[model samples]
Target chain A: MDPINFVILAAILFAIGSAAVLLRRNAIIAFMGVELMLNAANLSLVSFSRIHGEIDGQVMAFFVMVVAAAEVVVGLAIIIAVFRARQTISLDEPSELKG
Target chain B: MVNPLLFWIIAALTVIPSLSLLFARKAVHVAMAIVLVMVGLAAAYVALGAPFLGVVQIVVYTGAVMMLFLFVLMLVGVDQREDLKETIKGQRWIGLLAAGGLGAFLVSVVARVALPVQEETVGEPDVIAEVLFQRYVLVIEVLGFLLITAAVGALVLTHAPRLKPRRTQLEVQRDRVRVGANPVNKPMPGVYARHNALDVPALDPEGQPIEDSVSRVLKIRHQTQDGAEFRAQLEDPARKDTEEGR
Candidate 1:
């Protein structure tokens, strides 16, 4: 794959997904958007590795996947418990935790 | 140069779902859109010659994690109706302003910036694995610990005895009322009352109905504090007299 094409596409996806995380109220949706952003970063990493003729970026991608998986399982479980307690999963509802 | 047609097609697939996540009114649709986007990203990863990561992305993310998200969404019944009012004041405007600012920054950077062109050498998964296991052995071990911790933690977190809420007064009252229905007074109609007027439920709270009775009957007895007792039974005579009087 041409690195530039991949870079451009990854940048666009990153931008949109970040915008979504910023704009959305629902925590799960925002988290999904954050995943999209992370995927975009993975795309960039892999693309760069391909360009430089190295496997390091690919390795980092593996680490990112691990972290993302961890975050999703624990993050979502906590979100579920919070929603049960508070009766709302919207980020706005959980403002008390901001401190 | 990359194949323009393939590039456009993959770009379309990836962008469509990401945008869908933005505009989908229902949380389920949004979750589904995220899954689609992950699938598209995996395909793009494969196209970029990271076949192993591509498969991992699909299997671990799109298959397992996103499905968990969808399951929770369904379990919590997060549909269109459950969308809470955005609680943050001026959030929309702030978001728009920030997004617009970022967009403008990106556009300006793209206008002036140019990425250096470079040649790519695609390697096989085995070669990648050699480099990963040999050079990055410790990293892999740490990742294994991370995965184990995550798995154990997830199981623990999800399975932990949630504070078993004491039944609410209303719920307890409702259950008591249902259970207090005496079995001898009259046979309550089956779940499908219209289907079997005489066919009382096996689990009915009251006694069985008389055969060939066209009208369903209910007998209720109330005991007075003074020890007087009276009974009310719906019989053909009582029903006929009531109907006639009405």
Candidate 2:
């Protein structure tokens, strides 16, 4: 399989994820979009690792996974708190800080 | 030669559900879709010869992180639908255009740039660990600290102080008297009542236990008979027959 194919796939997935983040109103779904983008990047990293005949890309992928996990934890906590306070998880609902 | 067929199949699996994840209306469905995508990505990782990352992707993202997402979805309840009204006018169209432009640019760049392709090397877990713990030790430690900070920050954000502060027995009694309601007798209103002090069974004002919608639809009701009598009748068919005959 051509390594460029994987890169193309990753690019397409990242684009879909970006579209989701842009278009979705639900904060959780937007968060899922962010995760999808991260996964796409991880795929590219693994592909590059294979292309380089080294383990560095895989190690970087592992670090990305760890960071993604931590990010989800904090992000979900903030989303839940916002939901608790305002009774909505819609990103546009929290306009108090908009000004 | 690497199997292109497997690569195409896994790539399709990874991409399809990730796109669907965006369209899922309910948060729970979105979470499940993301899990499917993560599993597909893990398969892709394995196909790329990073077995360790593939397994870790499944264990961490699909297993733990997705579970956390599901937990939050359930905790917050999935019944609340998001308001679809756009806060910023024409944002959706602009976003779509931007994303499309970005995708085209990336694909073109990837096609044009010829990276030197080396022979595929299967990542050995031992070498990864050695490099991670030796050369990238500081980075690993920093990630550990970030995780801890995330945990603490999550707790701080979501923690709600108890509505009723801790009070002595006398203070509780005085508050009950002052409020002109017996704290021990009256049921607390609202979904988040701290405790059911009266040990009252969950029942409506009609003195009947609230039946679930499914049970109501099925026309099922609780038996009025005692537990011991119900057990005896189940144990002896003859006795039940005699009672019916009588």
User: For this target, which candidate reaches the highest lDDT against the unseen true structure?
Assistant: 2
User: What would the per-residue lDDT of candidate 2 be over residues B1-246, giving only the tens digit for each residue?
Assistant: 348998789888878888775577777877887898889888888888888898999999999999998888888788878787877899889989998898899988888867777877787688788989999999999999999999999999999989987899999789878988745553332121433322223445684543331223233354222233434656798986897899
Cα displacement (Å) at residue B97, model 2? 1.2
Q: In TM-score terms, which candidate is top?
A: 2
What is the Å distance of residue A73 in model 1 from its true position? Answer: 0.8
Clashes of 2: 0
Q: What is the DockQ of candidate 1?
A: 0.53
Which digits, one per residue and each the tens of the lDDT, describe model 1 over residues B78-110?
Answer: 752534455667776787677657756764564
Any runs in candidate 1 off by more than 4 Å, and if so which?
B80-86, B107-119, B160-179, B183-246
- How would the docking of model 2 be graded? medium
**TM-score for chain B of all predictions:** 0.64, 0.68
